[model samples]
Target: MKNFIHDDFLLETDHAKELYHDYAKNQPIIDYHSHLSPKELAGNRVFENMTQLWIDGDHYKWRAMRALGIPEKYITGEAPDSEKFNKWAETVPYALRNPLYHWTHLELNRYFGIGDLLTPKTAGKIYEECNAKLGLEDYSARGLIHRMNVEVVCTTDNPLDSLDHHRDLAESGWPVKVLPTFRPDGLITIEGAAFIDYLSSLSKITNIKIIDFETLGQAIKKRVEYFHKNGCRLSDHGLPHAYAMDFTEAEINNILSERLQGGTISKKEVAQYKSAVLGLLGGLYTEKNWTMQLHLGPIRNTNEVILSKVGFNAGVDSIGDFQQAEQLAGLLNGLNNKGHLPKTVLYNSNPNDNELFATMAGNFNGDGIKGKVQFGAAWWFLDQMDGITNQLNALSNMGLLSCSVGMLTDSRSFLSFPRHEYYRRILCNLLGKDIKAGLLPNDMEWIGKIVRDITYNNAKDFFQFPSYVEKAPLENG
Candidate 1:
């Protein structure tokens, strides 16, 4: 067997090895987007056990297990920790070439210095060792942040949240920065019966009398402003595709008025409402200088029976056949022509649309704005080794890879910090191999700087940092 998977592997050039080494060793983590709990970060809490930390909030593993036909007993069921570990161990070898394989190995190595493969043979030892260390004082949430060298993290948050957790973290003067991104998906989706209930929730949060369409608009506006005041500088939207319907404000008001009267909307009316309102939402984001993110091409809620049994996000969403480029172009062109567009990041899942997404991402930038309009990395199902490498190549060929802000885990797992390392390794290998073949120049200093910037510095500078700085070094150090 090979001594090491990444042993002196040079992708760009032989000389590039030194550069990759320097960058990988020193770069801090800047997780600009994720779904980690701000409450846990604020409290700096410790984990009860490795199972709770690894599997409790990870729907990815749950989805993979479902794919392997492992019953829910080993999944979200009431199985013992050892049994769950055994099941996960059984699934590890089958996850070959999956991002989970790399991530699992990287976490084991990074957190526990255990380089051995995890099969049923090694599962018990790995579990016991990790559990023993997790009982120590230095394994708290904040301590883990320090251990991983995470500089900042931005969490997806609802428009209705008071952001008390964020405020508390800010006031605590912790080393790591935890902030929020404004996610208003529930407020914007008007097709469901829950739209009226969402409206009620918004009404309570904004303290506005949302009696009609005009008041509804005002209530959303107020909440966006509230989120802005709470250190939110980005807005996020998840959609099947970009909206293309263009209609007057009065037309939208008419639809809202009908809905207020308890009238059911036609399919056409639903499209019209969603399209117009998404445009309005974009305009609001533009005016506020918020970096707007639109994630497209997901066909959510696929497993009807499982969806009914377990609800959404049990990992049933698949890619949709959406022509995102033309629609995105139309929407962004409208905004850009009006001079009302902010910095925009577009993310999609369909690999076939790579060229389309790359070209369209570059189209919205009229002036020489560095990141005014950009393409986000492979997200969700595409956030794997092959997926991220494909995205990097596409961006490099079509757009500017250096200017492109790189990988974000978008995960709920605390052990997912290794994902950043995984991305860095893949990136270095790609660059190193290219340089080795004399495709790119072997400039170690410049290459190292670019690696570090993409891995850490770019995201740190892009987002706003918290007010507090680091505490003084301990006397012993």
Candidate 2:
């Protein structure tokens, strides 16, 4: 029987095969945004089994297993590791047409050199083989990253974090650049239950008492400077919608004081506070010449029951339909008016906003930088093939796809780097189809340069990290 994951699995045309194999396949990955634990990379930990490496903290697979009627015990509970692997194997056959189907086979093939289909029949043998391989040095966390040709990884971090692990990794002379991204969502989430606790921690970390909005801004600025000195060149925010409410500093101060006094505030007040803080943060990012990424349109923790049981990022978030265009325009315009709009990337989870985001990015894109404002790669919930193609088409139609910096894992697993390969094959196939249909000129050399740039070079030029090629040679298959 033919294996499902062959060398040209997603590359359907000869043009795609040539482009992917020649230009995109071996390009080093610059995962500028991810949620991988820096501690694990610093420690160079090795997993004990396939379950630990493949299944742990992977909510994508968990969501699929739950849909297949697998119990939570086997998915996230106290089931034996082998039992969990068996259950995942059982679920794989049912995941046909899902991205998981391709991702599973891709990971198996790329990481373990296993091309056989994962089934109840092959699960035990495959599990044993992968587990045996995990014992080797090349399968450790750093080793796996090295094997994937990863050049730079920017991890999401909070305002109060120490970044000690990042320091440790750098001082240890690790070749890959592991940097931190400033994520101050907690500060903007003024209505969250833990808002007060978060403020307390920030105060402790910065040694600045948070009395009002001014003090809060000053403390956050201090942390931003600290992060910048430590090699942070990016900031990330996740919001259901952009906030651009009109308010004064006095009003913001009163609102913060009221909220800090354990008072209940209205939604309008929440918007005012968030807008003030986010606008100020934008100026800070501009001052330091850092990129700011806005990930919008996710309504997280929709199920209260699940929220009470498992908490956030546990696979319960969904696309939000909030009116994004007006307020998003307001936010960017407000920053641009001050001449403080930093290089920005806008990512939307809802497919409805694909064209809107692409066009919105065009509104603010000049200032000498090629892609100063970008419609980021199809984001969470939109990272699948159809979603990716839709985003690509929208950007090509509405903006300059040539200058766009492309894909990131946005993942928590070390094994997820194959997603870059998956994205490249899909990208090449799209261009290949265009050439074949006479929609685009038959120019493989130019197209191949675009492919290589999107795969690696665009990110290198867009970001502030030292060049990877200057430091070390990229690994090739």
Candidate 3:
């Protein structure tokens, strides 16, 4: 029988095959955004088993298992690694059209070279095979990344993080660039129960005792400069929506002071404070020429019961219906007006806002840059096949698709790099389908180059990362 995944798996036409194989496949990956642990990369840590590497901390698979009524013990509880892998394998066959099905199998095939379909019957055999290979030298943490042809991995970090792991990786001079992305959601969010606690942590890290909003800015600016000195070039924010309301320094400072002193602030006060913080951080990013990423529109941690048990980002989050256009445009325009809008990437989890985001991206393009403002890659629940396709279609219709800094894993798994491969196949298929329908011309070479540019070149120029040449494995001096 033929394999389920093959050379031309998602490519439905000859033109698609040509674009993927000839132009896109071999291009190096610039995973500019991910939640991968910098410590793992720094230590080149090796997993004890397949479950540790594959199933553990994988909320994607956990959600699928839960959908099938699998108990939490088998998912995230203290079930044996074998049992967890077994439950995941069982969940796979039932996951049919879900993106998890494709991602599960793709990671299996890519990492272990196992072509066998995952099922309850084959789970044990496949699990053992994968664990055996995990014992290999090439299956080590950095080795896994090395095999994936990733050039840069920018991990999300808070302003107060030491970034010791990123610093360690950079100093080690591994061929793959492991960099930090300044993600200050904790800082931006002032309404959370832990906001004051987070402020204390930031103060401890920066030693700039925060008495008010202006002092908070000074502390965060110190951290941003610290990150810039340590080679950070990007900042990422996860907000329900943009907080670009009108506010003065005094108003924000007063609200922050009250909050800092354990006094509750009103909702409007929170918005004004968040807006001020975003604007302050935007100016810092602008000074360092760093890219700023806004991941908006997710009503996170809605399941209070599950949230209480599992903490946040445990897959209970869902797409939100927040108004994107006015708030987004307001924030971007405010920054642009102040010449503080660094290159920005906008992402909304709600599919309803695709064109809204795409057109908003077009509204801020200038400074001779190719894509100064980007309708960023599909994110969170939207990082699947259909979500990716819809995003590309929206961008193609509303903006210059060629200038798009295409596809990011936005994932926590090293194996998730294949999502980039999946994206390239989808991109090629879309263009090829267009050509087949006589919408685009029959020019292969030009179209092929566009594929390559989206796959790597656009990100290369867009990020302005330090030069990298993948070399041999690390050896003792």
Alpha carbon lDDT of each predicted model:
0.78, 0.90, 0.88
Give the Å shift of residue 291 in candidate 2. 0.7
Worst 10 residues of 3 by lDDT: 468-477
The parts of candidate 3 lying over 4 Å away from their true place are 468-477
lDDT of 2 by residue, 302-419 (tens): 8786567666777777889889999999999999999989999999999999999999999998889989999999998889999899999999999999888899999999899999
lDDT of 3 by residue, 1-477 (tens): 887888898998888888889999999999999999998889888999988998888888888899999999898889998898898888899999899888878888888898889999999999889888887878988989889899898999877777778767877878898878999989977888999999998888778899987788889888887777667899999988998999987898899889988999889998898888899989998998999999999998888987888887788988998888888889999999999999999988999999999999999999998999999988888888899999999999999999999989888787788999889989999998888889999899999999999999999999887564223223200
TM-score of each: 0.93, 0.97, 0.97
Rank candidates by lDDT, best first.
2, 3, 1
Tens-digit lDDT string for candidate 1 (81-194)? 788878888888898877788778878777778888889999999888888888676677777767888877889998777777887787787777787898988876777878
Q: Give the root-mean-square deviation of each candidate in angstroms.
A: 4.8, 4.2, 3.6
RMSD of 1: 4.8
Top model number, lDDT: 2
Residue range with the least summed lDDT across 10 consecutive positions in model 1: 468-477
In Å, residue 448's CA in model 1 sits off its true spot by 2.7
In model 2, which runs have C-alpha deviations exceeding 4 angstroms? 466-477
Better of 1 and 2 by lDDT: 2
Q: Which ten residues in a row have the lowest lDDT in candidate 2?
A: 468-477
lDDT of 3 at 155: 91
